[model samples]
Target: MIRIENLRKTYGKIQALCGIDLHVPAGELFAYLGPNGAGKTTSIRILTGLTRLSAGAAALNGHDIAAQSTAAKRQCGLVPQHVNLDSELTVGENLDLHGRLFGMPAATRRQRIAELLAYVELGDRVHSLVKQLSGGLKRRVMIARALLHNPRILFLDEPTVGLDPAIRRRIWSLIKQIQQQGTTIFLTTHYIEEAEFLADRVAFLDSGRIVAVDSPTALMAGVGHWAVDWVSDAGLQSAYFPSREAAQAAGAARHNGFTLRRVNLEDAFLTLTGKKVATDANAQTVHGQGHGAHAAATRNPTGGQAKKGH
Candidate 1:
C-alpha cells in the first residue's frame, strides 16, 4: 500500500537519505531496519508526510505524498516513538478528542475508542489519566489514539523499544492482530529479532541507501551457502558446506563441528552494513554524535514518541 521510488532527503551538508526505493504491499508488515544514522526514520517521516523529500516520488495507496498529502495521510495511522498524549486528559478522553479531530462523530468515536482500548489491552485503564499510565500503557494509548481514525495503513516506529519482555510480547501480539485484520503495517526498528519475528519482508538500510530488501529467508540465503567462522585471536577456523556431497567433493578442505546452519537477518544486516551490533546497554554515543542532549535531539526521529500525527 506504500510505494517509494528514488526518495532522497538531505539536511544542509548531510545527506540523511539517499534514494530509498521501497514497496510495501497491502496487508503486509514490512520492517525497515538500520543502526544509528542509517536514515530509517528519515524514510519513515517522508512516508508519513511529516518530512518533505528532496527528490523522487512517494505514494500511499497510489496517492502521491507531495501532491495529495492530506488524502494520503488520512489513509494511514502513526504511532510515534515518543509520548505525545496530553498528560491532563484521561485515556478515553484523549482518544475521543483525536477521533473528533479526524472528523469522526461522537457515537463512532466512542465505539472505536472502546474497540481500540480493548485491542491494545488497555480497556480497564481508559478512565485513568495518561500521566498515571505505565510507559507500556501509554504506548498502547498512543496506538489507540492513532487508530481513532481507522487508517488503512499503520506506521509504527520502534513500537517495542523500552518495554519489558512481557509488555513487548503483548504489543507484538497486538500488532499481529492488527495485521491479521488487514492493516498494512510499515515499521522502522533497530531490533533485528523484531523484524525476523513480525515482518513479511525486511529491508536493510545503511548510510542512507537500501543495501538489501527481501524476505528474511531470501535475504539470508543471498548472503552465501558457505558458513565460515574464525575464533577470536586463536586462529581457529572452520567452513561448513551446505550439503554432504559438496563437503565430500572439497575433501580435506572441509572441517568438523561446522554444521549447515542458515544465516539469519542479523547476519545479513551485519554483512551488508559492516557494523557490529550495538550490544552495550550504556554505549550511547552513535555515529560521532555524543551521548548527550545534542545526540538525543539529532537522533533518529523514531527514537521515542515525539508527535501524534502530521
Candidate 2:
C-alpha cells in the first residue's frame, strides 16, 4: 500500500535520506528500525506531506505523494513521536478537531470520536483536558485522534517512546489490534524488541540508507539463533552461534561471566551496522541533536509552518 523509489532528502549539507527504496504491502505491519538522525522521521515527514523530498518518488496506496498530495495524505494517519495535542482541549474536543480538519460531518465526527475513544480504552476520559491525562493516556488519545478519519494506513513514529514497559506493552497490544483490523501500519522505533514483537517485516536504516529488509525471524537467523555476550577490555562483546549448545560451549570457555540469550533484532542490527539500536544514553543524545535542523527542513505544504512536536 506504500511504495518508494530512490527517495532522497537533503537539509543543507546533511543528507537526511539517501536514495532509499521500500515497499510495504497492504495490511502489513512494517517497522523501520534505526537510531536517531537515521532519516526515519524524515521519511515519514515526506510521506505525510509535512516536508518535501529532494528527489525520487513516494506513493500512498496508489497516489503519488507529491503529485496527488491530497489523495496520498487521505490514505494515512500519523501519531507523531511527541505529544502534539492541545493541552487545553478536552479529549473529545481534540479528536473532534481532527475530524473536522478531515472535513468529516458533525454526526460522523461525534460517532467516530466515540468509537475511537472506546477503541483506545479512553471512554471515561472523553471530557478530561488533554493536560490532565497521564502520558500513556495522552498517547492513547493521540492514537484515537489519528484514527478519527479512518485512514487506511497508520504511521506511528516512535509510538511508545517514553512510556513505561507495562504501558508500552499495552500500546503494543493496541497496535496489534489495529493491524488485525486491516490497517497497513508503518512503524518507526528504536526499541529492538518492539519491532521484533510487532512487525511482519522490518527494514534497518542507517546514515540515510537501508541496509537490510526482511522478516524479524529471518534477520535474526542471519545472525544465528543464539548469542553469548561477555565483558572484554574493549567493552561488551557478543558472539552468535547456530544453536544453544554451541553458545553454551562458547560461554563455558570464557573465564569471566557471560550472558547466554537468543539472538535478537538488536544483535542483527549491531552485526550489520556496529551500532546499538536503542540505549538510554543514545536515545537522549540523538533526541537532543536534531530539533533545529528538523524544524528548518519541514514545510507544512499548507502555507504555514508545520506543527511543532510532529
Candidate 3:
C-alpha cells in the first residue's frame, strides 16, 4: 500500500535521505531497522507529509504524498518517538479530542474510542489523567489516540524504545493483533528481537541507504556460516565457511566432536556491519543513536551530507 522511488531529502548541507526506493505490500508489517541517523525517521517524515522530499516520489495507498498531502496523511496514523498528548487530559478526553480533530462523527468516535481503549487494555482507566498514568500507560494512550481515526496505514517510530521488558512484549503482541486485522504497519525500532518477531520483511538501513531488504530468514541465510563456538586448547579459534555443512566439515577435520549452535540476527548484523555492540547483559545491543555502519559510496544518489546520526 506504500511505494517510494528515489526519495531524496536535504536540509541545507545535510542530506537525510539518499534516494531511497522501497515498497510495502498491502497489510504487510514492514520494519525499518537501522542506527539512529540512518534516515529511518527522515523517510517516515516524508511519507507522512511532515518533511518535503528533495527529489523522487512517495505515495500512500496510491496517493502521492507531496501532491496530495492531506489525502496521504488521512490514510496514515503516526505514533512519534516523543509523546505529544496533553498530560492534563484524561485518557478518554485525549482520544475524543483527536477523533474530533479528524472530523470523525460523534457516534463513530464513541464506538472507536471504546474499542481502542479496550484494545490497549486501558478501558478501566479511561477517566485517569494522562499525567497520572505510568510510562507504559502513557504510551498506550498515545497509541489509542493515533487509532482514533482508524487510518489505513500505521507508522510507529521507536514504539517500544524506553519500555520495560514486560510492557514491550505486551505492545509487541498488540501490534501483531493490529496486523492480523489487516492494517499496514511501518515500524522503526532499536530492538532486533522485536524486528525478528514482528516484521514480515525488514529493511536494514545505514548512512541513508538500504543495505539489505528481505524476509528475516532470507537475510540470515545470506550472511553464511552457523558461528558455533567451543572452548578448546586453541582458546577461541574462529572459522568462516560458505555454509553450515562446510563449517561442520572444517570442525570435523579439526576435532572429534564439537557443539554446534544456530546463529541469530545479532550474528547476521555483525557480519553485515563488522561492528560489535555492547548490551547490559553481555549480549550485543542494537546500534545506538548516530552509530553509522559501513556506508557503500555507490548506494548514495545525492551524497548530500558529510555524515549525521539520527
Candidate 4:
C-alpha cells in the first residue's frame, strides 16, 4: 500500500534520489539494494516523515506522506541501520515509550507490550535493561518496538547487519512471520543472500537511480544461473554461465584460485552497475568515500552535510 511518483531528493549539488517511482502492494516484501550513496536512507527518511522530500509525491496506505504527514507516518514503522533504542530503559519501557509517542492508551499499550515481547521471543527480557541484551536480542527489541503501534508497513534498514549468521537467520524467520501476518515490509540490506531469501521483489539503486527491479529469481536469471570467478593478473573477474556444465567448463579453463557458485543478487548488481555492495567484513572505498555494505549516506536533504558510518 505504498505509491511514489518522481520522488527526488537533492542536497546542494548532489542528487540523492533521482526521480524514483515505485509501488508496493499490500503485504509484499520489497528489498531495496544499492552501493553506498545511492539514496536508500534518504528515501526512507522521507517516507517515515523524518525528512521532507525535495519534490514529487508519495502516499502510504492512500495518505500523502508530505501533505498528510501524521497519518502517513502512522502507517509505517522503521527499524534503522544502527540500533537507536534507549540503552538505559528496560525492554518493556522502551516499547512503552514508543507506543506512548503514537498516543496509544495505557491499557492498549500494556497489552501490545506483552504480545509484542512474546512475538519477538523477548518475554523474559521484558524487565531486562536494553544494554544487557545481546546484539540479536537488542535487534529483536527494536523490531518489537517498531511493531508496538501496529503500523501497516515495516521499514527495516539492514535489520541483521552485524549479527552472527545463526542469529541473523532467526531474525529472518521473525521477519517472515511478520510478513505472513500481513505487514508490508520494506527491507534494505547489503547481504544479497538475505534479499534472495526474504524479498518477493527487489530493486537495485545505483547513483541515485534505479537500475533494475524484479523478483530475485528473475534478476538472478537475467544474469545467468551460475557464476565462476578467478584471480587474474588484471584483478578479480567473474563470468556468468547458464548451467552447471558451462560453469564447470569455465572453471576448467581457469588455472588458479577458481571458484564457481550459483549466481546471486550481488552478481546481478555487479552486472548492472559494475559496483559491489559494501558490508561490515571489509571496507571498500570508491573515490574517497567508504560505502560499507550497511553504510547509508545520511546527508541532509536540504544541506550538504552527509554523515556516513557502518
Most lDDT-accurate candidate: 2
> Tens-digit lDDT track for model 2 on 120-223?
98998999999999999999999999888999999999999988878988999999999999999999999877888899999999989999999999999999
Q: Candidate 4 regions off by >4 Å?
A: 279-310
Model 1 score (lDDT): 0.75
Tens-digit lDDT string for candidate 4 (176-245): 9999999999998777777888999999999878899999999999999977765555655679999978
Clash counts for all predictions: 6, 0, 3, 3
User: What residue runs in model 3 are displaced by over 4 Å at the alpha carbon?
Assistant: 229-261, 275-310
Task: After the best TM-score superposition of candidate 1, give how far the Cα of residue 174 lies from its true spot, in angstroms.
Answer: 0.9
For every candidate in turn, the CA RMSD to the true structure comes to 10.3, 11.0, 9.4, 8.7
Candidate order (TM-score):
2, 4, 3, 1
lDDT of 4: 0.83
What overall lDDT goes with each candidate model?
0.75, 0.87, 0.76, 0.83
lDDT comparing candidate 2 with the true structure: 0.87
Stretch of 10 with least lDDT, candidate 2: 301-310
Which candidate do you rate higher for TM-score, 2 or 3? Answer: 2
TM-score of every prediction relative to native: 0.81, 0.90, 0.81, 0.88
Which numbered prediction scores highest in TM-score against the true structure? 2
lDDT per residue (tens digit) for residues 1-310 in model 3 = 9999998988899888888999999999999987678798888888887788999999999999988988898999989888878898888899999898889999999999999999899999989888999888888988888778988899999898888778988999989988998999999875777787899999887778887899877886776546444334543334445676876666566543443434545556566775422232223233221122321111123222121111
Q: Model 1, 82-151: lDDT tens per residue? A: 8889999999889988898788988899899999888887899889998998999998998888888989
